[model samples]
Target: MNRVVVVGASAGGLSAAEALRRAGHEGTITLVGDEPQTPYDRPPLSKQLLGGDWEPDRLALRSGPDLDALALELRLGVPATALDPAARSVTLADGVRLEYDALVVATGVRARRLPGTDGVAGVHTLRTLQDALALRARLRAGRRLVVVGGGFLGTEVAAVARGLGVEVTLVEPAPVPLAPAIGEQAGRFLTRLHQENGVRVRVETAVGEVLSAEGAVTGVRLTDASVLPADEVLVAIGCVPNTEWLADSGLTVRDGLFCDEYCGAAPGVYGVGDVARWYNPLFGTDMRVEHRTNASEQAMAVARTLVGPGERRPFAPVPYFWSDQYGTRFQAYGHLRGHDEARVLDSDFAGRRLLVAYRTGDRIAGVLAAGVAPRPLRALRALVAARTPWEAALADPNAG
Candidate 1:
């Protein structure tokens, strides 16, 4: 490819550009980002930045000299407005048209917000650096905060807020937080962890509306008509892929941009990161992982596919993710979603440690561990990678 245009300036897009250079691509690369800031790590936004432990400068993914060495044409703060697959060109909001021989769509996702809460003070969504800074400014000791989702984001924020001496109330629409993503047992464990840290846990409830007065949020009303008085509200229900710019691009776009086993959306066009819902041959399904590691790993894979001399190989990988709450660390390997069974291989609730294995049919689909040593967790991850049979995995002494 003579020219490469990468849409998105975050982890995935920046990784792609860096990998292309490392792979000896001497052609032109144009990186487009809606945010004006240089590429920064996002995982810290919820934990360190929100908790007042880290500043925005500390989130930089690369130093000034390092980024400058890439020789990239950086277009920051201007979002892409449209894409023309036939013309192989992208139109930016600033009316700049960029042509490319290859394209990488890594626009990623945006935090989902509650309805009718726009322009309301004391309401927030933690997706961007600015979002974290704004929310952090509002957090302080004795402040009452209400979090509207039980996913990883909401839970982590709750943990950090609690550490800041803030009173936190977590509201979940499910029977338990993260029961659908993880398992009910693990979810319950997390719920108890939050409670032990002095957070009020509310399950099987939905926020009916954000109660506001004079354009300032006062509290939230639950579906049952119960009101949660709060100084601030964080809506972390989910995220929406940044695909609106590709509406007329003739590429398949639904919940995410559809791609093949090679991450190809069309000849000379590919999708990466959170914006990609690509077929994974290892799992025999199509999925879009929003994890930090996946973004960088997939970007390197796509880079090799683009610049490699040989035939492209199928992009199949054992998915992995992790979360930190209170003082415990939770990590998982392989695909845990849709597993029919989960077996607690080990437990020590008092010590805050556990290892669980998830099964689909006769094979081990995933493994999760909390507060486990790195060496043991690595061994467990291997079992999931091998697709070990359910009984065989249980029989193996080192499986956990």
Candidate 2:
């Protein structure tokens, strides 16, 4: 490929651009970003940044000299408006069209917002740096904050607000937080974690509407007709992949940009990170991972495929993700979602330590642990990566 155009300026996009240079792609590299600022780490936006523990500058993925070393043509503040795969051209919002021999779609995803929340002050979604700053400004010692959605993002924000002395009320539509993703046992543990940290946990209820006054959020009305008066509200329901630009680009755009095992969407076009729901050979399924680790790893895989001197290799990886709440960390390896069975391998509720293994059919599909030693967790991760049989994994002495 003589020229490469990578759309999106987030972790995955930046990684792909850097990896291309590292892989000896001495061609024209254009990194297009919708946001004006240079790429910044996103995981910290919800934790350290929103908690006022870290400044914006700390989130920078690369410094001036570091980014300069890559010799990238940075195109910031202009969003890709459309894509023409046959022409191999990307049209930006500024009317600038970039043509490339190879293209990488890494636009990632945008946080889903609650209906009728537009233009409402005191309402927030933690997706970007600016979103974190705005929400941080409203989080005060005596402020009341209601968090809709008890997923990883919502729970983390609730924990941070509680630590800042903000009264937090967490509402979830599930019987327990993270039950659908992680099993009910593990989800209940997280529920206790939030409740113990002074967060009011409301389960099995959805938000009817966001109440507003004078063009600002005053509270939220729940499906039960109950109102939660709050100084701030964060809707951490979920995210939607940024695939609108590729609507008519002749690529399969289902939940995300559909890709093959090699991460190829079209002939010379590939997708990575949250925007790509590619097939994973490891688990024999298709998944789009939104974790920080997967972004860099998958981008590196695509880089190899793009500038390879040999045959193309499939981008297969054992997906991993973690969440930090109230000084405790929860880590999971492999595919935890859609597991048929979940068994608690180890537990110490009073000590706040637990290890759970999720099984899909007869194989150990995933593992989740908190307060467990790193050594044992690594061993469990190996089992999941190897797709160990359910009974065999349980028989192993180090399984716990």
Candidate 3:
């Protein structure tokens, strides 16, 4: 427990590193990241920072001096290429090998690119600070922005584009945006919301190829042979877990690196955040949460497991995520997937109300509301933790 190493520059990786040091490891701590710059906050990159309303420094969760003050050996700009479980060592991209007593894999994920869109200029994805910078510069007024995929990122970017006075068209292959997680009813309502706010939404519209003119994006040609003109295109299709570097490694990796409840992958190696898949006894499944809360909780768990455990907290933190669209703050608690029914606890969907979600044959599963007070959300977290029955929670005791 003297020395610990964490890999990844994403939220989970950074959180894990900071948690280990703050918990008084009193030993050598190293943070290795693949991305060149120091670890920066990502969620804001899609909202405030990319929207040109916030400075780049505002996107940083912690600064360089902060890492030094915490006494961490931050190996920034280096990515781990391989893992040796038997020898307890990691191979960096620069052919340097480092050994550690314990390791935490928080390598997060990378955005999936369009097959033929790479050579096309003006096509972009917003997963990193660099990507945001490039896209922000292109957010000029009168520009026609076509956002591929109607997921959270695409929708959020559309909102920003519209706000910047750019003509935006969102192309989604799904029947509706967020229909997979939030249900079709909710997704339909959201679609209307977007259209009302000046975003042109196209459902079940697949982009066959990103049209290019002189090596730069001109528009997108849909599967139906219709061509939609655009000056810039944002691809927010999805993300891939950064577990490829461990292909030859001993640890098992499916969608993400598999780990136990303690965030430990092997005896000493741990995994967290978007690159981790851990069993949640509460949910009776292997949960791989991709939220800032997961990063903080998993890092704390990994830190406790590495250092001597005095008193520890469980890894059963209720997952939480938030999104900003059209100047409204949206928040969610608990897992949204695997839910059978959604109950309107105390929400006026027309005017930003709290919506409580429940799982089939069980208790509350998730929550969604517009601008709810922080206090009630905490109570809902308690209810979700206690596995509170939905029927009683439906009465809306202190609606959030």
Collision count of model 2? 0
TM-score-better candidate, 1 vs 3: 1
Clash number for candidate 3: 0
Q: For all the candidates, what are their Cα RMSDs to the real structure?
A: 0.9, 0.8, 1.8
Q: Candidate 3 lDDT, tens digit per residue, 281-344?
A: 6666788877777787788777776665665445776788887888677788877876888765
- Superposed model 2: Cα runs more than 4 Å off: none
Clashing pairs in 2: none
How much is 333 displaced in model 2, in angstroms? 0.2
The positional error of residue 21 in candidate 3, measured at the CA in angstroms, is 2.1
Cα lDDT over the full model 3: 0.81
Please list all clashing residue pairs in model 3, or write none if there are none: none
Model 2, position 92: C-alpha lDDT score: 97
Q: Give the lDDT of residue 7 in candidate 2.
A: 96
Q: Per-residue alpha-carbon lDDT of model 1 for 164-252, expressed as tens digits?
A: 99999999999989989889988888899899999999999999999999999999999989999999999999999999999988899
